[model samples]
Target: MSVTDRPVPSHDRIARAAFPRRRVLQAGLAAAAGAAVLQTTAPAEAAMRREGWIRSRIARMSVEQQVGQLFVMRVYGNDATASDNRNMNEYGVASPAEIVAKYHLGGVIYFAWADNLPTPAAGARLSNGLQRAALAAPGKVAVPLTISTDQETGIVARMPDPATVFPGAMALGAGRDPELTHDTYEITGAELRAVGVNNDYAPLGDVNVNPANPVIGVRSFSADPALVAELLVAGVNGLQSQQVSATAKHFPGHGDTDVDSHTGFPVIHHTREEWETIDAPPFRAAVEAGIDAIMTAHINVPALDPSGDPATLSKPIITDILRGELGFTGVVVTDSLGMAGVREKYGDAEVAIRAVEAGVDQLLNTPAADVQYNAVLDAVRSGRISRRRLDESLVRILGMKYDRGLHRDPFVDESAVDEIVGNATHKARAQEIADQTITLLRDDADLVPLPAGEVLVTGYGDTTTVNLAASLSDHGHPAQAFVTGSSPSQTLINSAVTRSAAAAVTVVLTYGADTNTAQQQLVQALRDAGRKVVVVAVRNPYDIAGLGDTPTYLATYSWLSVSTEALAKVLAGEIPAAGRLPVSIPSQADPDTELFGFGAGMDN
Candidate 1:
């Protein structure tokens, strides 16, 4: 059945069906006791008792406290050590303790530089310290802060060494197994939770149609909208099943644009029809699958709002398109307001005020927290921003915190941190997923599973060449390594060819060679030197177009160590290449012709 045609059961019915009879009876008994109290208690006490805990907490919050609940501040520090706190002045940002005490911040987001501690124990301590600070802050109602990070596995991971570095979104799509995708995210969720993180900004929903897209390259799952939607839903289920809130990001789609929103505004000129077919489906699927948050993109879509306001500040895009039309009632969050796409045009105060008015539930990662907090307070007090609207966002933000069980216990077990993060089972699963995602695009010469012989491996430095060479050696295939950086000179290419002259086969690894003429020249020189060349794209699969009709070609979609090991095993015939191309590969002969369509993989 189509997604739209699926039946959506009523909430009451679902609740009744999901709860056991004994649990239902317990609820009934509580309701009866509450009714008895209603009859005996004073009117105000009865009202407080009748209202839900979340609403009751909101009723008592001061205006400043209520406004503070909407902001998720960015903090900087390598760990929660006292020395790190003393060094906060270096970054010119307030310490976590001061920010929580002054602003009553709703959430905290960690970046690579801030949270990349040497061990999982340090990370857990940092998270615990942040939670303690938030709860102790002077406020009418002390709510636990939502701690989050970009733990999106591949290139965007914040915790690398201590966390299981799984293959990225494109690899998940190439594997074509939603169950594996779900399991991969489940393991990620567990690790994040182990360190006291309750939210993960992951599972990119953008359909990567443009190969040259700078930001959302391999971050996206597939170019096909339906495929992206399916994998996005699976990823959401995986995350939420582990009690971590998963975010579907850069919404209203940031896939087709060439400009990175980090530095400049990207404009998507698609009409409404095109958006419905290409961009809107994955978001719609996410909402239907019960995604906890939908992050607004900074890109401007002319069709959605002709005023040219980026979606982060455009009411038409966030309120009308996402909330009204798409029916995403979950928390609406803004991408980092500090990005040049939004920050360049508006001041911090104006950005915060306009984003709330635009229906954003959470204002994320603004450098100037004081300016934003005071601006929002002023707007609400002056009646420029409605109290009702403020309350609406507060409820959603607090609801997520409550659902995450933060109210009961906000701290993680620091002792268990080492036991959970990067465990043996999760690491093995990471390798399994990487093995499943290695695609063999071209093997016309049947050079793969090359008989045990001397092999020459040339690639981008130690991470790619050294690991691949060791894996080949593990499989009884002795291999030599040639480490060439992105821009390889002709002399290096000559050295590679001469070294491979006596070898049985030459394996060349590329990182986005499709756009680099120097790398293409190196590959062409290898082919011309009568070497049996097998080009493996370690990063971008589009590099296949650069090497014209190479006898054997493969794509690993990532340069992670596990991915490198998987590729080596595939080359040594220990495992078959099972992954298909998630995106199309343009032909070298005709730039307009696609040499390999989506889901194209060769096992033999």
Candidate 2:
């Protein structure tokens, strides 16, 4: 039966029922699982084989079909027939394939919590199945989907086992080698392509000027806009060169806010003049480099738009500022619509309508796909969202798919996934990049090449500490690890102090120790006990500012396994520390005073 003639399903009817704004907008997401495999893809071919394929396709599309093209929904399950509670809760569908068919979806996003990335073969099967369903859906245009994910590498990497795990944007920024940045992302793009994902929401272009930023900290390349701009372009080139569409995200910048937009709205107080110099540079660079897509931040900037609407719903920010001022003609996509930053100001349906009116080309991860789809469909039929507007977004969205070669072939060989992702070459290159990001901030005690004696590795995540211990041991340094959980309690700290009594040297690996007194106490306690204390800020470098007289400290800019291994090598004198601080370290005692300025690092 044709898609239009098919009887409305019960779930669709339920989704269409009237409900309170909060109920419709409420969304839940589980944390992603850790570790996975990887894959590789060929260099991009010429843009869609047929010059006018998108135009021809759009001409034949019905309003309903055209509306579908503007959304990239989230679904649960690793394969077409797979179903789970998360799928039913989020999409009201039985399986991932059913969501694609029922919604006539433009594309679907993969998330680990949704069971969308259990294994490389599983991911390939899901991608291939979704593409088939998209073409087979009755009355729907046979356009392939732009399968996407947040494979930002480092802390945000989603591809599991065997996928090469490289350092994050900040780490690469610390290395300050654009060529290395390009090589890293090229490997990233190849792996994503091998898993059948066509788009990656990565290579953040935000300049993190605020050290107190609760979100975009290590995710950003650097606090220097020029540096961020330089690395962003190389990253974009690398990903697109591998045929995976690269997205420069959180436009107008999300790097200066103390609040995370995922849970709260953040306002950038930067005056227009300051924004021009600080926040606008990277985005300008992205446009010049021909980035494929730009993701909008759900942030409010009064200097640009006095309307109080966040960038996602403000025409002044999106249309006037981005499209007109910056001249970015590429696809403009909204951050997840379910985020509190976007939804707190409007209802679910209104959020979608306003985003489109704001000149956004796509709506990503809406609270409920059916509701937002119907809302946009109704608005289009009523002439509220102009036909010209709808056509503009359709052309851009479809063009992305075509240019990325999704239209030509969206299926990946499941069996071949194991051979491409996390292969020997990718792993070795990732390690090399990781080694380049280790920065030795201080070694006043001259204990860096570490004394020849037993060592105790403690602090932060249990897995991370254990891994560091193993990596150190692998480098011929005898070590034992002590777990101090994410937020180490006084008991845990006291226990660690007692445990370190027998060690010749105590290595405290901190996460966010600048804010956790227990972590600082653990470091101080070991020193008070007359044991040599070496503090390694595995996540953020600001930790040292809180520990007043730390004699030896290092910064890895991330806590990924590869980064930890690199730290082990540096600590064991197996490699020299070569990284510099990507962002400045602020003084905890006096926020006005500088703790350590940017570009502060010393070689071992």
For model 1, the run of ten residues with the poorest summed lDDT? 1-10
lDDT of 1 by residue, 230-268 (tens): 788878888888888999998899989989999999999
Candidate 1 positional error at 271, Å: 1.2
Candidate 1: how large is its RMSD? 5.9
In angstroms, give how far residue 590 of model 1 lies from its true place: 4.8
Model 2: worst 10 consecutive residues (lDDT sum): 31-40
TM for candidate 2 is 0.91
Error of 1 at 603 (Å): 0.9
Candidate 2 global lDDT: 0.85
lDDT of 2 by residue, 1-604 (tens): 0011112123222222212234222233321111111111112223333447888889888888899888899887787887777778777778888888777778788898778888877888899999999888777779899899998888888898878999899999888777788989999998899889989998999999887788888888888887788788889988999899989999989989999999999999999999998899888878877788999999999999998899999999889999999999889999999899998888999999999999999899988777899999999999999999999898889888887888778888888898899999999999999999888888898888888888899988788889988988888888999998767788887898898888888888888888877788888878887878889887767888888989999989888888999999998998888888878887877778877777778878
Error of 2 at 526 (Å): 1.4
Report the lDDT of model 1 for residue 258. 89
